[model samples]
Target: MLHSRFCCQWGNTLSSTLLRFPLADHKKVFAIALPMILSNIAAPMLGLVDTAIIGHLPDAIYLSAVAIGAMVVSFIFLLAVFLRMATTGYIAQSFGANDRAAQRQHFNHGLLLAVLLGSAIGLGSPWIIDFAMWIVQPDTQLIPLASDYIGIRLWSAPAALITLITLGVLLGRQQSGRAMWLAIITNGVNVVMDVILILGLGMNVKGAAWASFSADYVTAAVGLYWCARALNWSPTSIHIKFNALRQYASVNGNIFIRSLVLQLCMATMTGYAARYGSTVVAVNAVLMQFLMLISLGLDGIAYAVEALTGAAKGQRNPHKVAYWCRLTLLWSCIFAIAYTLLFWLFGPAIIGLITDIPEVITTAAQYLPWIVLLPLIGHWSYWFDGVFIGLSLSKGMRNTMILAAAFGFLPLWWLGLPLQNHGLWMALSGFLLMRGVFQALWLRLRWRQII
Candidate 1:
């Protein structure tokens, strides 16, 4: 009886300790982050599979064409990702306010914008392809293959945009599992079709494009059905306001510019890497894949913070926002540390699996230390991005990105010219670090005002 009483007391003490330390907050954050993390990690595989299949072809030009084509499309698509970001912010706030009508209205506005814009992109495919090719200045041999890939992929623009909107809604509503399932189904189909069309039917890059188009539509269908059920909406009940449209344009426009600048920074980096020779380019590419993988995983947590913090702000609960932010930063730090360790210990083996080129492998392994450092140095900016987006403070986000690219990255790259590839990696790391620092300063100054 005495031992039982002592055990009960200890249990009470432990529970109280956990409550005070915000263990429950961690649980809430993870509940939303884990699925999104899985989805984000899987999303990249679609591109990787495309690259892998094309890389195995006898000619290197096929691989180059696919890479260039996909990069161009991805740049355009990523710029429009403001659709997802703005939608998430608006819907999450509405959800927090418990305003179902506003939620549905925002959904309608977002969907309409996506459809109109996507249709515009598809209709203007020829001009876009020409413009992209002119900017890239690809070899004569690659132009046709790249053109074919871009043309077919453009057909999926509408579906891709629709999927983006649905995902934003699902995430804003904290329906992470549903969102994840949609990604899995979509990417899964793309992978299967990649094999069939690329290998079995000998469609090559065209096959890959067709596979993405089909998978996108499939995902959009599933997303639309799921969104309808989740929102429990009738066609008649949905409303679109001109004022809401203007607001969306305002928010998304800023985000669009921000994303555009970001793409330019990345493109410039790649262009410079190319000047160092094909071996350096391949090595950098593999390193970038590592960085992207880490970022996607971290983005999962950032996304959760976006939803939770946006909701907290909508409800005018500063304490809740602070709580979520602290927990998210803590979790992000934990993840960064784990990633650092993983890359440090196993990066060479991972690089080998990515490619068999001995020169690329040797060069990449030499730079493995930088990859190990990336997660730690770069994660804070990602976390800040979530915080800014959640609070609908997009102007700061845009400004910081511009500043980071213009001042932080460019200057460092210029100064580090003597270091070659090492200099490039340094500049990239500096960009991320400066972005986090500047944004943090902005947040600090505006914290009370935002709340």
Candidate 2:
């Protein structure tokens, strides 16, 4: 009876605390987050749609080729993702400072940088593809198929990077709805083209690549239209300062390293899975979809945090930063718990929808528990990542990821090798958990400087 009374008291306290949360802030967060959630999900949907289409082909080689080809492109793109991250933080802070001129300048600079980098990647595709193929050493049968896919997709590099800058600008300005629309149109077009070219026209992997290529340019056009309207573009208004460019490059350089390491971790995961045989590789691929879903959903909230916290920093308001941090953390935890429950209850049904092979299903189930726990274990790192990006603390972010990869993930994998696939999942979980812990500790130690 005494324990029951204590529980009731605890529940009441929790309810009271929640009741005191600012409704306006909650609404603002969801306003930004909901659209972003949809937008982010559309990104992975492109890959999913591709996988679904290719997987239905007569040979599994098609699926493997598409998978490997997509991985190579994703890794390269992610390395340049600093275009989005840096642009968002810079623009957000500039917005908060009410510096319209600075904002316009940054916008122009971002686009210029995007164009230069994207063109470089496109022009140098041969070397990039060669490097990736050497690293992965795909099955002989898949080399030509994968190469064709990569060859066609590389042309979209410039458009893709430009869209990234445009979306970053809108998101940093808190115009998430517009940014969301851009993503929707792009992915939606890609889906339609994928169905038409691959399935309708029977163009195979090359068709899928062409669909993505076309959708990218279309998305770039839309993004350019919206961005021009927002900025009311004028040639006279554009100016570039050498100092500003240097500063931008410095921040992006750190982010570049951070992203490089993060992608390396993912590539390592996929590479290791491939060694376990075709069945295990297929199982890991399906399981990765679950992780991607969680990331896209959680990243919505993280994006909002990035905008709000960056603005707070520009305003020099520690209190506002702290408030946003608390609220976002609460929401993240709730989502993490919900994801855990959903996966635990419906893991089988979800797996069934992804693949029909009975053996794959059975093998996946043996490892389902790890995926179920992923959201809970890794949610904090996602949250911390937003905070660091918002504040432009890229060095700390880079350090923590390096530490997590080297100290946490590598050692754990070595120790758990006897467990095979289970060991990989365990190492991944440890890597994520350590990333959050180390980042949080770093933030705590440097809180004063950031605020």
Highest-scoring model, TM-score: 2
Give the Cα lDDT of each candidate. 0.87, 0.87
The true-versus-predicted C-alpha distance at residue 104 of model 2, in Å, is 1.2
Question: Can you write out model 2's per-residue Cα lDDT over 297-357, one digit (the tens) per residue?
Answer: 7999999888888888878889988988898888899789989999999999999999999
**How many angstroms is residue 388 displaced in model 2 relative to the true structure, after the best TM-score fit?**
0.7
Q: What lDDT would candidate 2 get against the real structure?
A: 0.87
TM-score of model 1 (CA atoms): 0.90
The predictions' CA RMSDs to the true structure, in order, are 5.0, 2.8
> In model 1, what is the error at residue 366, expressed in angstroms?
3.6
Against the true structure, what is each candidate's TM-score? Answer: 0.90, 0.91
Off by over 4 Å in 1: 1-22, 45-65, 195-203
